[model samples]
Target chain A: MKDGPDIARIASLVGDPARANMLTALMTGAALTASELALEGGVTLPTASSHLAKLIEGGLLTVAAQGRHRYYGLAGPQVASMLEAIMGVAAGVGPKRARPGPREPAMREARVCYDHLAGEHAVKMMDTFLARDILVRDGQEIRLGPNSHSYFTAVGIDVEKLGPSRRPVCRDCLDWSVRRSHLAGQLGAAILDKILTEKWARREKDSRVITFSPKGRQAFERAFLEV
Target chain B: MKDGPDIARIASLVGDPARANMLTALMTGAALTASELALEGGVTLPTASSHLAKLIEGGLLTVAAQGRHRYYGLAGPQVASMLEAIMGVAAGVGPKRARPGPREPAMREARVCYDHLAGEHAVKMMDTFLARDILVRDGQEIRLGPNSHSYFTAVGIDVEKLGPSRRPVCRDCLDWSVRRSHLAGQLGAAILDKILTEKWARREKDSRVITFSPKGRQAFERAFLEV
Candidate 1:
């Protein structure tokens, strides 16, 4: 066998249509149960179990026990990034017969990417951060700006208490729909978590779309968009 | 058939072992004939032909005839970026039993990523550019710095006439092995083209490893690493 990282194995695991559906559903960043995933994937429960087993075995997903039920989520942000990149290519090269679904517009407006916000609203937040110097790019990496600590703390994301992790504090992920980028990594997740916790936005039921109330949207703008 | 981009079709194309090998081999940015790809993929010519046809149909690759031989290469930069991203996830989630190949060390030191240089040397060049303010990141986008035009022209890369293309002038590609970023996109390709044209390095036969002579290596450092 030619020696290198095994690309074929991972690609094969994701190549299955049912599994692809399941994985995409998990991109909402929510840990879902097998039955829910089966429904989303349009596969039987047994088939879903088998697919989930393979995904877990491949490390593309992680399983956790909540109460008497087990829930599945993407392994982490890296897997999400990989899947997003794949979608970018798929969108680029797929047959030109695409017909947008009813949910397409809402999804393109705002959605969850793994654990972070994505789409138009998310892009705006990232732009505001950069435009106001809350975050700056150094080389290819996004670094905390001079006032980032103060800015994030002001928004209830205590930078000092983010704890330690191998993941960067600030990173950017390409938005496939817009061909732009939104914030990702730990800081991005924190911002998203804050949004949901404060009831600024709520994830639409059984979907990745995030819906913000009029007041919440205004509050979000005041907090993240104000220079 | 489900909604959104057709990811399964594209992932399935990359799923097959032979096809995955073929795609990775083409990531060197050199167009190879069916026979050469067959050798790289460890498959028979007929099988390689079948795979090549499928890849072309899928838009992951493009073919052109040079003289009597048909050479196949990746369709474009987007395809290459997709493959690199896939490799990143593969390396992340693959089995932990990786044993280095004979050429692994050399490859990790320096390799070609599609039309650009990758690995350590490429990373250093990116760092130097940022440090010297020759390239500045403006909100996840790399734009020309004050001295960028002059610096690139001094190095024989005319910033004015790169031509109008949808491709970004500079983008950062994540390096899987190092968990760092390397320069990619149009400017990146130009630098690589210049390096090869100037005989600062030569591509290894039958591999992606770039071999820079002792003097060439020194010159590269002096030019890029100099303050």
Candidate 2:
């Protein structure tokens, strides 16, 4: 209470079950309305409205009112980064749940990060690119190195048309389940699309996990030198 | 269920009350042991152990066993990112909490972020520097621009002695509370330290909130130009 507000404010805002549930729903980065969140959190609409108010007051979220429907989203990328940092500690510190049976191994392997791919394999893919000089770190953003131009060009990425001003590349989107960086941004979306179209990876119904077909595995190995 | 396992996987992982509480504690970015977390979550050690096992097996966490104590943390920065995304959604979509009353207000204004200064004021300070051509963004880092050396020198920051390779001159640390980037790195730390030393700000124990005194406010206004 003595430390003005800052992290404590953000922390307390995230500490509650209803609020946490609402935030978890927003993880996909899409804007949602109040009633939808109320159902997601299993609370009444009025109660959800109060919670939304607190979050906005706390500066953890922003509200966009379009006529009768008001859409809310995270205030900015910094909020995402902070939540990620906390999730890291939570995962590290919490007790693990019990998994039964032959364990759906695919969940542990690679998964979708929002709309992109992430996991041990994803990290390996990133590493392969780095080793091949396909991508280089440019401050917080990753840039497609000059050497990797051919790979993208071969894959039909049309990097030349993107021009020099716009950053036409992939960003390291952090994967919660896989605990590694996955390709994000325009390139990431394109890659995800390509995989789905080629039937290399299929999205599992009701979950973020992606199951790779034998053909997909082979393709991934061939395309990015999958580790 | 049609979106594959991504939504369900993330939601179920965070659905449990005890696990959620444990995650709330870890949001501070500090690692804790299973027993410590057990106590915090109001669960038995064995129950905490089981949860920890599930989280680890689920690939949401990694463990570093030192002697008899096992230290756990989010698998990596990717996991952190995922968690943040989820939290953003929750904060955006959830119900609100009642106010706990103001115990301190100054601390909420500005404070140190890891190693640098953060909050609204810190962000404004960065803007000031950029406007004056005293700082330049270099991809993932910030460097002194053409006029920065002389500008900082006039402001009492020894640029020549600091050296170019010693540390990052400037970069933005994502501020969770403000959901914006704040000044980070050695320069940030220096400014924060100077503020505290000159009685411009004071720290609130057990939290990172910093309060600015009347004199401190005036000094900061004079030094940083209206931040």
Candidate 3:
């Protein structure tokens, strides 16, 4: 038998419904207080605290204490990707829910997957990049081409400055909603941050959706799509 | 909170250590009996039965009864992929084990991942396919091009007959051992099966390792590599 890493401990941490909900809520890339996560998970504060403690101890999440409150977020991008992978498998294998949430449409349109963009808009952006030869796949690795530097620079993201990090510059992460690949890694996070900084889109309060204004949509298309 | 499929329930099924060991043992893709799994998991037969029942009920596994013996295996490829993904994240996050198992090196060299091959050999095969243009990646999708039809057909896997399945013909599954993409789909399964049938390799009893003879290894490289 293959003796790999112990997966049961980490999985069991996410196995609880309330903890799963808390982790899902954190997929927005926002740090939330224990009470807030409790509300998000539909559990009491004590219960949420216990779960959060377990998650932090399990290394799937990290916490920071600021002033009177401690905030929790996913430990890093790996945790987020693992959660997304789980969601992908769960979508295909598990039974469908009877009633979809109100945020379903918005989430399917655009949402924050960890620190990057996901859903339809993200998929469209990825396709545009691929079609334009801004990104190329060398085997399983996704790398930015010579043209990508100038293109990202024109969009206010300094691709040069994103180098030297332990994190990859380009990564293809599976989108749970679209069942397609989206941009991830340092470049992915930078692009999403640039989009928000430009006011082209804004993340919905207390949710994962990224809502775009009409002007913002037009601007995004003119910049990314028209290429 | 978006109520998609319940991920926690399925994750919890994989959370228990005994169950996790059993599932890991099943990664060999062998239909093992309850007693075998119990021995592998270091659990009593009755306890293994309970865990197996829970896994079956949760749709993570399926069982078949032949005569007085009941055999259990992963429900489908999705389950196996989910487990691999979990192992990936766990490897990164979890605490390291004190002593590595004896089979660790061999498993990393060549092993069965569900119905497909994984580890170094599998990665090499995938790299060869990509280099030869037998398998072309169009964005996130891996497609067999014009050359692949003849190439696979010559290898005894009729590419034409692999159509019409809900499952994909070419898939890029991340190899947990290699941290690279390997072929996984109908074509992947077909190639692995061919190796076994040709006596090029045989799955080690009660293990995931696919032991290849010296002659078999030479033949495999000649067929897959020197293209």
Best by TM-score: 1
Each candidate structure's TM-score, on Cα atoms with residue i matched to residue i, is: 0.78, 0.50, 0.76
- Fnat of every candidate, listed in order: 0.68, 0.02, 0.67
| Ranking of models by TM-score | 1, 3, 2
- Whole-model lDDT, model 1: 0.83
Greater-DockQ candidate between 1 and 2:
1
Give lDDT: candidate 3, residue A34. Answer: 95
| lDDT comparison, 1 vs 2, better candidate | 1
- Candidate achieving higher TM-score, 1 or 2: 1
Q: Compute the interface RMSD for each candidate structure.
A: 2.0, 8.5, 2.1
Ranking by lDDT: 1, 3, 2
Give the candidate number with the greatest DockQ.
Answer: 3
Tens-digit lDDT string for candidate 1 (A1-227): 35457888889988999999888777655677999899878899999999999999999999988788999989987787778778978887775535566788888889887679988989988889888888987775788898898888777789877769645677777776776778888888889999999999899877778999999999998998885
Best by lDDT: 1
- How many clashes in each structure? 0, 43, 0
Which residue pairs of candidate 3 clash? none
Q: Taking the tens digit of each residue's C-alpha lDDT, what string does model 1 give over B186-212?
A: 999998988889888999987888999
